[model samples]
Structure formats: structure tokens, C-alpha cells
Target: MRNKYAIVIICIVALVIIEKENNIILRVSDKLSQFRTLQMPETSSFVIIDDNSSYPDDIYSENVLGAREKGQKHILLMATTRSGSSFVGEFFNQQGADMFYLFEPLWHVEAMLSLGTNGTNSSTSPWVYRDVLKHLFLCDFSLLERFINPPPKDHVTPDLFRRESSVALCENQVCTPVIKGIFEKYHCRTRRCGPLNLTLASEVCQKKRNRVIKTVRVTQLDTLRSLLEDPQLDVRLIQLVRDPRATLASRIVAFPSKYQDWKSWAVNENVSVKEEEVKRLEGNCNNIRMSAELGLSLPKWLEKRYMLVRYEDIARDPMQKAAEMYNFTGIPFTPQTRDWILENTHSHSSGIFSTQKNSSEHVEKWRFKIPFKLAQFVQEICGPTMKLFGYRFVDNEQSLVNKSFSLLEEKKFHFS
Candidate 1:
């Protein structure tokens, strides 16, 4: 009996020892895996070659001379996804008859090129894209109307235009009916009009003092150099940038169905969100750096013609920013513009991109919504670009203090 009891005791002790050993092994394995993940390659495939070389002086003179002669005011808002371009576009869209705003007209061309439709393939070439855009900026919408007439439902449907936007264009007589195939008789509307009655649209478009286009598709600044070089067109650029962390966080929350891969970037259900934020941080940093570099390299004529606007700055003080932008473009800052800004930014909304909050609140709301660790990770990734843009970094200490203060405030509110 004693010997049996001894054996039982020994077996129990051995089981406990084995369990402890297994636990140690697991912990070590976990640590090593974490170490490996952190060590994974951080370098990105995208690179920006800083071409700061100036273009010939004669080129600038010819283009400026031509723009003055033609009396054109062409403005392009070059931006990327989640960069508040829609907000800027809508803001400009409210300028009424003074400005004609086109939203992502290149979306169809990009879609067609991606789908290999109409014998177009991935290798269709950059010149094709450039030429299409060049003709597009000139108010020649024949090609633009083809994609809209049939309605490239697969990529960009005409219904993307808000009812008010469509009505505004129609009121201006820029041929919104062209998209619906209702105005075929007015096909000979403008000198640059295409087969689709784009002439009527072009004629109305020409009357507007400012012809504005907002697109997030242009990867290289040089893509629009040809249009800039054209003497007849008075082209200007608004390079819009936003805080990458906020942009990425907004994208992850808002575009779950579209950016499917973002969900996988989180460590937990939320870790993929952090990962996606980091990736976007890296990408936006690259883009912002390239834009700044390109702007510096531009010839004097093009350089003076471009403006860089931070979304946060504009959102914080829309009136001030609007006044400055108008002054820069030589456009009149009317009472209607201020009223529109107040109404649109504060009024009721129908879409995800609606601006329905106090401007400053909207700009700062992202900080509270994102997890501390996630924000820190993104900040680390976008540190350089953030610094360049004068954004305050969210450090660990700041995050902890913020959370503690938030908890205290919540408790105080409950007690009161």
C-alpha cells in the first residue's frame, strides 16, 4: 500500500512538471514569432525619383501667353483616397455658376483600362491616359460622354452624382441630359464638343470662370505636364493632403466592403485596422513626399500656379481657408460661398462622406475614435511626413493621459 501510494504521488508530480515545461515552450515560441513579425521587411516597392530639374523658360512663356489669350481658368485637385477630396470638391461645387466641377471623370477610363474592355489592356500605356485627360481638361467630353451614356455600371455609374449636382449642371446648361441621352439635337454645342452633345456641356463649361476637376487617380505629377504645357489652357493644381493616420482610420471604418484587405491588418479583430493604418501611413508618406518634391522641381510658371492645402487646416477654419484660396485663384469670395460652407458643413447629410459636424470637431474626432496603440503605430510609420506637415505626434504617455482623463470625465459626468 505504501509503495502504491508513492507511485501515485510520483506520477502526479511528473504530470505537473510536463505541463509547466510545455507552457514554457509555448511562451518562447510566441516570443520568437512576434520577433519575426516585427523584423519583416518594412521597405515599400513604390519609389519617387526627385526630378527637381527646371523646364525650359520658353515653354512657360508660351503656356502663360496662351492661357491669357484663351481666358481659361483650369484647376485640378490632385489627391489620393481618404484625403478629404470629396469634401473639397463639394465645397468648390457650391460655387454655383462661377465654377464647373467634374467629379472623377477619369474613373471610367481607369476602369476600362483595368478590365481590358474594347481591346484595352493593362499595358495600354501612359500616353493614352495622358491624352484622354488632356482632351478632357479642354472641355472635350465626347470620350467622357461615351463612358457615361452607356453608364459604366461596372466601375462608375452616373448615379454617383448627387441630385443637386446634376440639377446644378443642367441649370447651367452643361448638358447633364447628355448622360441620359435626352439632348442629342444639341450635339453641335461647342467647338470642342464630341459626338455625344458634349459640345453643349463644353460651351456652358467654357462660360464658367473656373473649370475644376477633382481626381485621386494621378500617381505622377508629370502625367498632367502636357496639359500644363498647352498655351490655350490656364491650368492650376491644388495638391490636397490629410493626416495619414486619420485618413487610413477613416478608410478602414468607412470602406470595409471596398478595402477588403484592411480587415486582415489588425492583430485582433482591431489589429488588422492598425495594420491597415500603418500601410496607408507608409503609402501616404510616399505620396506626400513625392508631391512636395515634384512641386519644388516644377518650373516657375507651374510652381506658382499650384497650391498645397492640408485638409485639417481647411476644416479647422473653412472661411479663412476659402478666402485665402479665392484670393490665390483671383476668384471672388461671395456671401453665397460663406453661406454654403456653413449650411453644408453643419446641415443634415445623406451619405458617409457628409460633412455634418462643426468643422473643428470633425477634424479632431478621429483622435478619440482610434485605439491608442493603433494611432501610435500609424504615427511611427508616418512620422517624417507628419512632421513635415506640422502634425502633433501622439506618444504613449499622451495616449495614457488622454485615456485616464477621458475616464475621469466620464465618471464626473455620471456623478453629476
Candidate 2:
């Protein structure tokens, strides 16, 4: 009887050991491949290891030595229109696996936030920007960029939402190496609570550096604080601002036709110093007030999750600025990442900002063309904000405020 009892006990122990080993493998394998169908066991309360692929690809196991070295951080780049955000984003895109280009997490966040499903008063224009970043990060979107410039698609639609892998969390096409050191804000409603293995995360898994998130709508301080609450999520803020003089000059010169009707009496939409319209536009600065409100919307609160970035610094030397940002986030900038930065940091090499797009280039050219008085007014109205970013305020030299066709018509000028 003793011998038979002992055999039964030994068999039970062997079964327990086998089950434990299987569970470990299950978890590890989830980080190795994409899983189309995943079902969690009732007993398991954490992320279930899921992989539709019976075999994994080499990309899953690829690691970067610098990543393991651990001295860099993730990047979150944000700014307003006419700012050099795209330039900054392009500069960071060269990080290989260590960095990701999250063009706009706001698109996605604002989309759901607008739904106000839980009482969030968000509008569609900006919220969609936040959520778009969330949607892209959760999935591999290399192919999506093939269609458009800056962004392949103009709008973030519901059809783009999907549940994918985050490598360490589980495997899928979304696996990338640079993120080993830092985490950008990636919102997934399905992600559950659990402890993370920092020891495992220390491994250098990508030859690239950390990731880049270029979602400018994230100016609200309250919004940023709420997003950074996730311990698993690392959100570093890179605030970008442009000089109002330069930005306004660029806007007018680049889009001269939009604001002005060259075909008729020229009028400065911003109100000319000499024309009756200057008072009209100056009196009703609602549009300017609204646009300026975006800057004012930034919460006065400060958090460690973010660092302010300047547009001039980026345009002057994107690589150097990128390295500084990488260091700020604590992500190692490997030689490989450095090389990627060297190769891909060329501004306007591609897209709407490309040489092919003369309209956008007008921004750079307007420095000489803008009439003195009009430029002065632009500086006067947007001076404080512009000076904050390094643009100089001009004196009211010659009141040759350039007028648009509409303003000219307002003057009731008779035809020759």
C-alpha cells in the first residue's frame, strides 16, 4: 500500500510541473507572433498569451545592444499649426525600432473623448487626432504610409480600430525594439491590470533608439496628467512653438490666394494699417482670439512626463535635438539610431512639405515678401506668443500693410 500511494503522489507532482511549464511558454510565445484569435482562460486574470502564428519571425527576437544599455527615453512631440512639428517628427522617425512616429494619438483619443461615452466633452476635429495615434501604435502600419504623405489617410475612421500586440505584452505585427526603454501613451481599453517584469524589459531588443509621438492636440495639461497615470505607459512631452511673426508670415505668403483675391482690389484680411478694414478686422479679432485660445488652453500645471521643445532648435539641427530628446526620455541612442537620424532627418525631402509642393515652401520665402506694416501688425497681435519662441517684433516702419482683394473692395477704389 505504501508503494502504490507514493506512485500516485509522484504522478500528481509531475502533472503540476508540466502545467506550470506550459503556462510560462504560453506567455513568452505571445510576444513572438501575431494572434488573430485570443481567448483568456477563466482562471487567468492577466493578458492571455495568444499567437495565431505557430511559427514566429526573426523580427520578434531581434534585440538592440543599446536598448539593453538603458540610457534613453521615449519622445512625445506636440505643437500648433504653422509650427515645425512635422520637421521634428521627421527628425525622430530615423530611430529605427527604438522610436515610433505616433503622428497623432489625439486623433484617436479625441474621437472617443468626443463620443463623451463617459462624459468627456471632446469635439471631432481634435479628438480624432489623439485616437489615431492609439490606433496606429496598436497595429503595424508601415503599409498605410504608402498611400499618403505625412499621413496616408486624411481621417481616422472606426474601421481602423483593432486589437494587436505590444511585443512584451503579447506578440503581433506591432513588435518593435526601440521601445524597450520608454513607453509613449498608447491607450487600449482591453489592457488589464498586472505587474510588469522590468528585469525582462531591460534587455536591449532593438538596434534603434526610442519612439516619437507627434500628437500636437495634447496641449491641455489636465489631459496629459490623466494619460500618464498608466505605469506601463511612459509619456514625455516635447512642447513645440513657432514665432508668430514667422508663422503668420508663412501662412499669408504660402496661402496668399486663400486669404486674398489678387484678381480684384487687394485687401489684407488681417486689417490694413491705412484701410478702413484694419479697424474692422482689428475690432473683430474673433478668429485671431479663437486661434490664440489654443495656446492659452495649455494648462498652467506642470508634470515630469513632458519636456518643452522649440521649433528653431529642430530646424537648425534635428539630429542634435533628437539626441537630446532621446537622452531626456532615457532611451539609449545607439550608433544605428544615430545613423537612422543622419539618413532620414532631411526636411521637405518628402510629402506636402516636399520640394514638389511650392505652396508650403512659400512659408520660408515670405520673409522678404511681406509688406512692412502688415508684418508689424501680425507681430503686434501675435507678438507675445511669437517672442516666446524667438521671433523679433518689428517697428511700424512703412504702413504698407499688404491688403487682400476683399479689403481693397471695402475701400471702394474705382477702376482705371
Candidate 3:
């Protein structure tokens, strides 16, 4: 009887111990569930990791996070070479001390990688272009230094392509101290500001409220999806397109040696439409049309991020278009920007890459320059692109040269 009583006592004691262990496990599981819930909120603003080594954690913590915290604005002025990009880019470049603008920084990328690649294909990978642009937008100039020939030493490069075009780089902090009288008029390259202190440029970039970069290197729009979707950046893209015939005419004059065959064809009027140069032009048109179509489609990622602006439209009314662009980018169209546009657009400076011009006359001057046959050839090849952008075709030379007969149709492109 005593042995039976002792066995019952042991059984009861075992049951009590198991109950306490079960309660402890349930309490631990509840605490773990709360921890997981806390982690969920961070998913909304996580860093995008492309490559571990290329984009170190420090860069994300410092630059990307900093930009996000400050709510900085980024603007990308995208266009083809000689498509009035330089002219259109000036609107953003001349937006006073608040804006930091980089003029064709990708020229260094292309130049560095041009070796061993066919001219038809991009010498550098599109990802390289995108990466460089991404860093630049975030005010991180370290990545771009890799492409600078002779490489930047201690973050200084004298050979930054077209350094003078960027007023931000030319001004006080980035360039050397200006002499009181003798060197007062000169700035940047002419000023002989010592090798560009890229570190200082980055510091200036961080101080500005806005960053704008103009590039002809980004041939396709979709390649920018990663950049557009980045949680850290509020990027706005403006794609400036000109009539292909006008672009070709401008290229023939601006890059005569490169377009020697086109020049000869313009003079001789005997080149076949199937020539390699003509085929290249056709490819360029198709790329532009494809990108425009994608942007106009209003995909979920591109909502309110993409804008297509015709060079002709801006040339027609510089101030109005400038205001529209500023409004689109959520920037205040300052009086300084307005004044600069009024002065520059009316000026008659016609250098190959000069942004200042009587834009109204410059838009149609191509008709007089390009031969009738060449213009027709461009129309035949770039017809779909031209039509999509509202450029009307000329039936004959009489219609082409008639200044009163406008080639532009009353068409509007809208994006969400």
C-alpha cells in the first residue's frame, strides 16, 4: 500500500514539471512572433543590392540613405547625340545655385570602353552606363572616377569631359579661386582651374537641392527600370527628341568626319537607302520609337516618371515649355532660370555644340541644309518614328522648303 502511494506522488510531480515547460515554450514563441512583426516594416524601404562588392554597404548607408532622408530630387535629361540635348539640358543647368548639373558625364564611360568593340554595338555595357548614372544621381562620384582615363588621383581629374559646360563645376567651390582682375572673365577650362577636385564637386552636389544629369549614352529607356524603382531616389526622366531629318542634318554639320559618307550622299544624291549609314540611322529611329511607346504605355513602374518632349515644341515657345518642364519636375521655375532662357534662346551663337541660338530659326534650318533626296530617304526609313512623334512628311521639295507650311502637327503626348 505504501509503494502504490509513492508511485502516485512521482507521477503527479512529473505532470507538474511538463506543464511548466509547455508554458515557457508558448511564452517564447509569442515573443518571437512580435520580433518578426517588427522586421516586417523595414521591407518597404530596403536597400537594393546589385553586387556586393561593387556597391558596398557603406555607400548605401552614407549616400543613398542620406539622399532619402533629405528628400532630394533627381532629374535625368536623356537624348540622342546632336538632338538638341545640349540646348534642352541648359534649362536645368541654368536653374541657379540650387541645382547641380553634370553635362554628358557618360562621355568618359564611352571613351574608356570604346576599344575592341564594334561601333554599331555600345562600346560599354548599358549596365555600366546605368551604374555610373546611378552613382552620379546619388552624388557619389567614386564610381565615375574608374572610367576617367589616366584615372583620378586622390579624387581629382583635369580631363573630365566638357567640364566647362557645367556651371556647377565652374563655380566657386569646385574650381580654383579666381584672380581679382586679370582672370575675372574666365572660368573652368579657360580659367585654368586646377584639375577638378571631384571630392569638392561631390560636396557641392550634396549641398544643392536638385541634381540634373544630361546623357546621350542611355539609348533605351527600360534599362533605367532599376534606377526608377529605387526607393532612395525620386527620379524624373525627360527624353528630348528632334525630327530625324533635322538630327541627321545637324550631325552632318557637327561631326563632318564621322558622317563623311552622309555628307557625300547629301552632295552627290547617289547613296542607296540600304547603305550601312542609312541602316544605322534606321536603328536609332526604331530605338527612340520603341522607348517612346514604352513610356507612353504608362506601366506601373513608370507612372509620373517619364516625359517625352519634342525639341521643336520647346523651340517654338521656350519660356512656356521651360515652365512646363519645371512644373513637371516639381521644381520652382525661378526668375533667374526664366531670364537665362529668354536671353540664350534669342541669341545667335551658332557653334556646333552651342546651346544659345534663335531656336525658332534653328529648328527649320535643316530643311535648307539636307538635300531633298536625303530628307526623303530619312523619312522613308524613320517614317514610323516620325509619324508617332507628329512630324509630317513632305510630299515634295516645294513643301519641304516652304517656311509658312509647318511640318509639325497639332498633337499632344500625355503621361501619368
Clashing pairs counted in every model = 5, 49, 1
* Candidate 3 lDDT, 1-416, residue by residue in tens: 99999999999999999998676545434433432342211212322223221333444456567664676889999899889998888898889889999999998767655532323344225766776787788777876776676667788676788888898998768876533443222247434676678889988998898999999988889888888777678898998999999999989898988888877766675653346776789889999999999999989989989999999999999999999899889888989899999999998887888889999988999988888888998899999999999999998999899999999998899976
Model 3 quality (TM-score)? 0.82
Candidate 3 wrongly placed segments (more than 4 Å) = 1-59, 66-69, 116-124, 177-192, 269-274
Model 1 segments more than 4 A misplaced: 1-67, 117-129, 146-168, 172-197, 260-281, 296-298, 348-351, 397-416
Sort the candidates on TM-score, descending order: 3, 1, 2
Best of the two (1, 3) by lDDT: 3
Instruction: Compose the digit string of candidate 1's lDDT tens values, residues 61-161.
Output: 43234555556677788888878888777667777667777777677656545443333333332444454455556555544433343443323233332
Worst 10 residues of 3 by lDDT: 38-47
lDDT leaderboard ranking: 3, 1, 2
Error of 1 at 156 (Å): 15
Model 2: per-residue lDDT, tens digit, 1-416? 99999999999999999998676445433422211133221312222222111212222222312322443344566666556675556555544455544455444344433333333443332322332332233232322221121222222211221211122222222322332334323322334312222222223223224555665454443333423332323446666665554555555545666445321222455433345434433432333333334334444333355455555555456567677766666666667656645555443453434322222333344445566655666655554545444455555433233221111111110111
Error of 2 at 26 (Å): 43
- For candidate 1, what is the total of clashing residue pairs? 5
Every candidate's CA RMSD: 18.1, 20.6, 20.5
Against the true structure, whose lDDT is highest?
Answer: 3
